[model samples]
Target: MADPGLLGPQRRALILDLVKRSGAVRVADLVEQLGVSDMTIRRDLDALARAGEVEKIYGGAVASGARAEEPGFEAKTHLASGAKAALADAAAALVEPGSVVAVSAGTTAYAVASRLLQVRGLTVVTNSLPVADLLRDNVADVAGTGPTLLLTGGTPTPSAALVGPLADQAIRSLYVDLLIIGAHGVSERAGLTTPNLAEAQTNRALIAAARRVVAVADHSKWGVVGLSAFAALTEIDCFVTDDGLDAPARAALEESVGRLIVAGSAEDSAG
Candidate 1:
């Protein structure tokens, strides 16, 4: 149980955090954890619901909206981190030096950007604030001039993505040799989906402005349909994913995508 003297707002905030992390929180558990009466906990949940922070269910509350279930930047970084790193490495290897590349905003895309720090004589465009900051800070070459980093301006989403009409407009006039995108979910049927509608709209622009599209995702993304489908599986030139992806998914993607690279395997197997 939490401290008896804890404030109401603080308790509600704690409950919100828990629900965001775990997807749902039971009223009974909240009552036990907060050391409050059932009625009090329900009142708190009701308040949160009224505020549109959460959706009230039978026994508890879930995330507010379908897209609201999308994990924030910090939360996603901890999920399948090792696999994401491997996928990023594989995806980065496909980027040729001196190429103009656009990297979408996601934890996996951030990982890919981290690996591209040493890719000299390149121009990288991105809609992710963290990705731009990472490249600006760590990039260095013999001439002390690193990649030309371009950032798209827009409203920031929960995933730290700059997504809106501004981002779309920024990408319209530009063309890139490659674009690496990460998804909230990927499946044979639903294709590449994302929880955020604005991000989805921005991603569509990225795809349109690129000659080649490489998608980076972990095995866990398979079969999880998000709120919006941004791109179909056939739109991807190369799909880089962890070796943990099941064979059936690999088979389907291999047929749909132009190429598939499995990271953390004995070899970079093509699907």
Candidate 2:
């Protein structure tokens, strides 16, 4: 009986969701985006803090540090149930009918790869073993026919990515229409980040090869910055995310990107 777009309580839910993705946010930004008083925004933050969804910092709030540890496939698979599905859907729609799409290695990329099976005449180049495995194993069973799947060769990370000079070199010569990237953390100021240096270089290679870059992330990716910077948000053309994103987080991403696609929403709005 309540619309998040209209109700204050629902609005707080949206804000909390945004804060969760973004590690930290300033109070001023929330106030302006929510079109509410400082007190109202503070109350919203207070509620989220009480609920253990976010912890209040000096200037703003951030998500609880419950899952910062690098999780395995089985682990992250159960983490954000609906958000991952929604992110996958959004990432999948961006793939063209007949095109070369390079999928980066990560849990989010795996989701995108799984959804991309719906498309015909797709050549998927990826560095994730699980991604190739998913494509290789299901190409016939899915009935869409086999699109050329290129697996990058390199040293593998615990997260299942092939990251090294060999993989980077292979990615250099190739080109693709779209690149669906997965990130450990995404921040407006810090851009996209990860813990692995090789993976970061490979991500750079992916960014270089693709005509358009689309960052696939749920609300959990926002605000958090990692050791290595993958790509500046400005380098990306589009961002595919779930509807849980707050207006400020969307706006922050929009500043770096030209278009934003909210998962499950047909609407495309500018920042």
Candidate 3:
């Protein structure tokens, strides 16, 4: 019988499963079980850390566990998969190298961060833990080549965002080339909104600190008003959304925002 060596992702999947079952996994054990070297195990851990799949500690890795109070970050990744991917790709294309950018906390923004990972010489300031973790974990790949990652340290919310006064204070004074934000909902009545009031305030500060504001939301978010509104429709420079948006809503948004970009199709621009 021939030995079938495991591939990278396959090996990583097994490692993740082991971590989940054991709560924590040791490097020595993984090396022995996978028949790989200690260096290979460490590299796998590093990649998993970058993807927010596991928490890498000094000796080994730990599984991600969600508190009863907060929604698990892993769960959010599954929502609006296609729409978020399209929106993220479109948004990432707008980011130029060496640009100063701000990304707010949300699954959609997380998607954008994933795409922006390879962009070189970008100075990214963000309030999302997942975004910060993604960039930080990729430090080796981006060393001297990728963006300088900055986090707005502050109070954390149920969604894993650092918000409140500390985040607001940091954002109010700085300036960035572009700010990308995801909203709970969008409507003619309520511009851009989120369920969290503190997040709303923090987002307003982000809007004020940037030269351009690009709002990313899927069709499902349309007309679903949240508890707080951050910015008015006219205040947004460009609105990026998925093709799932209906023609009438698209027309209305085009009339409202400075420009409207529908991902996965020719843009419907209004300037």
Instruction: Write one digit per residue (lDDT tens) for candidate 1, span 122-156.
Output: 89999998899888887654355567899999999
Q: How close is every model to the real structure, measured as TM-score?
A: 0.74, 0.73, 0.72
Find the 10 residues in a row with the least total lDDT in model 2: 65-74
Cα TM-score of candidate 1: 0.74
Q: Residue 138, candidate 3: how far off, in angstroms?
A: 1.2
Residue lDDT tens for model 3, 74-183: 77678789999998999899999889999999889889988887898899999999999988888678555766888997899878899989999888879999999998
Clashing pairs in 1: none
lDDT of each: 0.86, 0.80, 0.83
Backbone clashes for every candidate come to 0, 5, 1
**Tens-digit per-residue lDDT, 220-265, candidate 2:** 8887655456888888788888888888998888777868888867
Candidate 3 — which residues are off by over 4 angstroms?
1-72
Per-residue lDDT, model 1, residue 89, is: 88
> CA lDDT of 115 in candidate 1?
83
Better of 2 and 3 by TM-score: 2
